[model samples]
Target chain A: MKGRSRGKVVARFGLLAALALILSWLESLVPAFFAAPGMKLGLTNLVVLVALYRMGDRAALGVNLLRILLAALLFGNGYSLAYSLAGGLLSGAAMILLKRCGRFHMTAVSVAGGLMHNVGQILTAMLLLDTWQLAGYLPVLWIGGMAAGLIIGLLGAELTRRLPPELFD
Target chain B: MEAKRKRFGRNDLLLVAGLLLLGVALTLALGVNRRDGREVVVRVDGEIVARLSLSEERELPIEIDGRIANRLQIADGAVRMIEADCPDKLCVRKGAVRYVGDGIVCLPHRVVVEVAGEDELGLDAVAG
Candidate 1:
């Protein structure tokens, strides 16, 4: 029974991971408005968050890693791998931590992940460039972060409500 | 049982207040502030492809492919490419968002035109 359950878990996570990659690619096609570099709708995050709520932290982490790898390869931007990894990992961690909190709703969890993702990306950029001056964008990023977080969080909240409960618990 | 509404905490209020202040400051600082004499950088895929610094008094028409942009004009102390071939025409409509936080991006063509006080600022922020 335990082995069967483990197989089911892996299969479910694999499916979620594939869905995330598809969503990531689809979002890339929606031309950005050019306010800044690396701006995205983060649709893949919605899948990951849904997977987290429906499955577990492990599944969410798996989906996150798979999506980043697939997106980097598909976009053909190897340099962005660092930024995406940092952002995805941090966001996933934040989401998992928020889930553990047991008080805040999915919207709050999504917001937390969104804010941390920006921070992670900025930190990665700073490390790659080897400069501290970029920190000035933190305020701007915070503003963008709030908006992005709210948007993604709202979507995640809706998904959370509609998702089947049996697989999540 | 009556469901209790969670009251906003001091930290939440502080965060919201900070956001408001920052929004106002950025709005005022970058609002309607044109950089006509500064250099414009066009970046694609984390690389600088074109650089234009227009200091001359005469206006120049920049044609992408064949058609001339309707509102793409740059004057002394301000630079703006107000038109493009993209379907959205958002960049053209942005009407020269020239600042650290302002940028006109053509995602379909992978073109981003932005005016900044210093190129180093962008490099440091994204590259650093």
Candidate 2:
């Protein structure tokens, strides 16, 4: 039974990681509606949030990291990899902490995660360029992040509601 | 585990609402305070390479490490990146920036063209 459950866990994480990679690719295919250069819908984050809730933090982190590396290798460069890694890790940490607090729902946690993701990316840009001029873009990015987060969070809530509870257990 | 099962509630609603309000407020504040910048400053690797008045219309080729990487065009009291050798050309696509805090950044080349001088709102310092 132990071995079977371990295998099941691995398979589940693998599936989630695959889903994340596909979502990232899809996002890239779509024309950016926002004016900002790095703005994204963060579709892969939905999978990370699902993993965080259904499987565990370790699984979520595993899926997030794997998805980032795989997506970067496939469609992004070293600079993009740095930005995504920083954003993904920081956003994941924020979500985990907010979820643990138990005061807010997945929607709120996801919103914070989205905002922190942008913040992380901006910080990475500033660090790499060695200037704070990029900081001017933060407010616009913040608003975009919050809006995307709200949408993703609502979708996450709906998904959680419709999925079989046993899967999460 | 049981705690994780709880659904969205009033606190969540309040948190979302508060964030929404904050987002709107920041947007409005930034928008309202924006003013046309007087000069355009081009920098490479964080060093100021050139500073030109926006009132003058001209095209400036930006060279980094002894190679021409970008072209800055200032016309009609606005500045823009009309050309860039970068793969994505994102800086060129950013279009014209006229406001004091507006900027165009080419990440690949590590080049930044930013507006400067009076009417500065000090947003970057506060936010950074």
Candidate 3:
């Protein structure tokens, strides 16, 4: 029974990662709001968020890593690849830790994750370019991340609720 | 453990509220008595080279060592790096700035263009 479920998990994980990549592509077409660079809706994060709850933290991390790598390979450059890696790992860690602490619900966990993702990307850019001036975008991006995270978190929670527990739980 | 994760709880609301509060505070801190630049201050190699007004629609090519290193344009109350000679060209991608604390930097040439608001150093409102 365990082996069978493990195989099923692998299959589902592949699909989830694909969904993440597809979301990233679609999100790119949305264009930058407020005419600001580096501000995104973070749609792919929703896939990782759901995987975190459904398949466990390790699986969620795998999903995020796979998506980032694949997306970078498909149509992203070195700089963008670095930015996504930093943000994805940082946010994934935050959400996993928050969930383990058991202090907040899904939405709250997602909110924090969202905020950290932006922080990670900004910090990465600062370090790469060797400039402190980039910090100026922090306040604006943080607000944008929180908004994106809240929406993604709510959607993840809904998906998790409707997902049948017999598959993984 | 799985059961505990379900449903939106009070702590979740509190967490979102806490983050929202932090975001708003950061914005206000950056914003107190500050407004978009009335003019852009261009500096190269730690020295001020020009003070271009945002109201004027003009482009200035910054010359260093008898060569144009970066170009600045101000229009519609915003400034951006229209051209640069750097290999990376990150300065051009830095986009336009309209508010205080916003800036575009060219690391290769050591050029720093920043937006200085109205109240940064008292009034600069006197007409020429």
Interface RMSD of 2: 3.0
TM-score of each model, paired residue for residue: 0.63, 0.83, 0.74
Which predicted model would earn the best TM-score?
2
DockQ of 2: 0.45
| Top-lDDT structure, candidate number | 2
The digit string of per-residue lDDT tens for model 1 on A54-76 reads 77788788889988998899884
How far in Å is the alpha carbon of B107 misplaced in model 3? 14
Which ranges in model 3 have alpha carbons more than 4 Å from their true place?
A1-6, B1-6, B32-57, B61-71, B75-100, B104-113, B116-128
Cα-lDDT of candidate 1: 0.65
C-alpha positional error of residue A35 in candidate 1 after TM-score superposition, expressed in Å: 4.6
Question: Tens digit of lDDT per residue, candidate 2, span B34-97?
Answer: 7778988787877778878999999999987788889999999999999898667878888999
Quote the positional error of residue B23 for candidate 2 in Å: 3.6
Clashing pairs in 1: A54-A168, A125-B128, A126-B128, A129-B127, A129-B128, B36-B77, B36-B78, B82-B92
Candidate DockQ values, in order, are: 0.11, 0.45, 0.31
Docking class of 3: acceptable
1 or 2: which has the higher DockQ? 2
- Candidate 1 lDDT over B1-128, as tens digits, reads 01223323454445446555765685465455444335555554345655666443334444444555433455664556656766666556556443443455543444555565665556646752
